[model samples]
Target: MKKSYPFLVLVFFSSCWSYSQSIATSPYSLYGLGSLYESNFGLTAALGTAGIALPSEEFINNKNAASLVNIPANNFFFEIGGTGIQSSFEDNVRKENRNNFQFSHMAFAFPITARSAFNLSLMPYSSSSFKISGLKIPIIDGNNEYYYLNVIGTGGLNNLDLSYAYRLNNKLSLALSASVLFGNTTDERTYSISSSTTSIDKKVNYSGIRPILSSQYKMTSSLTFGLNVKSPTRINANKVQSVTVENGSGSSFLETDKKSDIDDFYLPLDIGVGISKSFKNKFNVTLDYEKSYWDSTNQSDMYASFSDQEKFSFGLSYQKAKTARNYFNRIKYAMGAHYDTGYLEIDNKKIDDKNLSVGVSLPLDHLSSSLYISYTYGSKGQITNSLIQENYHKLTLNLNLDGIWFVRKKLE
Candidate 1:
């Protein structure tokens, strides 16, 4: 098992590279930074992505870095996970279906000392993949004529984070983390008229950094409270554009090439709070609330306006204490739900999302390594005012491995 660790890591990274190429598919992704991805993974995801205040000795909780201090000394925790989405979209006129599978996240956590812990992770910050077409307009050029326009967009961003957590006392823990965000997106628009076609391609590149502060308090043995804050960030933006025209005889020619600087993109401050309680080690429940002050930024994209965003989450888990008995008794079952008033507003309507999820975790070996699987069913937006409504089902898979990374050797 020790020798296979290197090979496993290599395979995991390679798979991540391949899957990252296409992470999401949604028409709503055409706006802003694309579809914002959830940060939950593994056990947290199984618990309905509501683990901010939950503490675990056997798992790594990325939601609240302060929880890292709860990990047992000398134990190294690693997680790799991915998601598969099946989605259907509909408007008043028509419906369409799309599906995607992609890597979700990878992380590692270990104790730096008895009082401090360290964690590092990589995950998608957002994803954009959408195509829109069938836009027809009449031209009154002496003779009545019609033209069509089609638009396609793709790409997204990724985040790399490094965090540290310290146990300040018996009841309180604190954490700080920094993340580097980077990505590129491409948008192409094509116009068709009179057997000739013209296309314009625009590409935007983004890079930024943000800092987060987190804290967890053990109010009592059965109850805990957590809070986190992310500061606002400014992302530098640059654009490269090109235009091409194709004639009726199938000859294509470049029309223009340009590079320019765009306005700096702004991200708003985000705050989250959560609480969790355990019932006799058999049942656990958690509740969480988060808000982003997008309205404070006063930012707007070309097609959509920004609104303050809020999310509420709830989760429950059940498991039997380990005993020399059936294997099923050791498995954990979890369920959760969440509702979000999204940040994007179009035509005086806000895009919203709601989801319900259920999951199971199967212990793999004596070291507390486990396989986690979860499913979420959700809907986003509404079919009103010619807007699209999205219904989706997502499946998540994760492998959590715990081992001893560094050990002292004794010689005779």
Candidate 2:
């Protein structure tokens, strides 16, 4: 096999010197990215929500672990993708933004004797960030006064994950993943009133570890079952700092001197099922169903404990291995849809989540080479009894490249 030495060196050194910049963050971290098996986004989430499974075959296939046992040695897979989001408040205000570039995934699989094999991968775990700002004026007394308020929020929950999988047999396999969570958040709020100006800023930083277990089984020629459990984690936000300033002197009135209490919680769990069948004419179809337990997560406050979220998805595809048509006719076409009942915990209130998505995958001449892309639109259902509810929408695109560098000869 011919190794991409330059790419390998780049990948290695980059990993070694990876630094945690304390300047920014994202809102997507609340829900896991690469949470779903495919690179496609969920109907409700720009890049799909956590818990969805992918195929587990020779391709480093997503779900169905048992399939990994059949994969050949010296296999490598790489994926890259991004998501864009547009948020709207009430019906008049519009907010649009995009997340940072992400390294979707990279994996290596090797043979252990004949029946068993091992696989390892590096992928993203979660990402989250959001900012809301508005101007407000208040009257403190009967006298004519001028006051302006500005609020800003910044941070993203990001995770780095490492995983290993062992195929027990042709029909079953087990996999485990260890993830290190790292990120920080900063909130800036300023109020200018009449002759005085006040500013408040808060920053929180955290580090922790989490784990995931997975299992897959093939029930028949057309049906497969998969399960994943994300262990709980106790993240230590040791640095919850705050600063307050008054007037034009630029002097500090108050500042935090110590860290806040440590917080810990479960990461939630997912269950999924898949079906793949072939038709007489060589056509193929695959479908997926998955469920997530957001309710199991520990809330930070009463408002945050209001409701839990759930998701559902479906995908279909058509492939022509060999056709009499032109070159493009040999490719495969696919589309999918995803839905979610948005999870919530606002002032002990529950909110609804709904979304829709579609995507496609194209195969290359070498079979392993392929391209994929998907997009989604959704909203956080009406907040009960509220004057107005908020809505959110997003788009996502992904590209994948994989191929065998060397193959063992049949008669070697």
In candidate 1, the residue pairs with backbone N, CA or C atoms under 3 Å apart (3 or more residues apart, or in different chains) clash, namely: none
lDDT of 1 by residue, 1-412 (tens): 0111111111111111222356667766777888888867666776668988987776778889999998887889999999988877766655766778888999999999998999999999989876656565556545679887677678998999999999999899999999889998899898899888889999999999999999999999999999989999998889888888888677565745588898878889999999999999889999999999999998887657888999898999988964426789989899999999999887677889999999998988766688989999999988775357889999999899999767898798
Give the candidate number with the greatest TM-score.
1
Residue 207 shift from truth in candidate 2, angstroms: 2.3
lDDT of 2 by residue, 57-161 (tens): 324553433445555554545555555555443322323332333445555555554555555545444333333333544455455665766545545455555
Once fitted onto the true fold, the runs of candidate 2 whose alpha carbons sit more than 4 angstroms away are: 1-58, 61-70, 85-126, 134-149, 191-196, 248-250, 256-262, 269-298, 322-326, 347-349, 383-395, 405-412
State every prediction's TM-score relative to the real structure.
Answer: 0.89, 0.71
Q: How close is candidate 1 to the true structure, as a TM-score?
A: 0.89
Q: Which runs in model 1 stand beyond 4 Å of their true positions?
A: 1-20, 138-146, 193-196, 246-257, 322-325, 409-412
In order, the Cα lDDT scores of the candidates are 0.82, 0.48
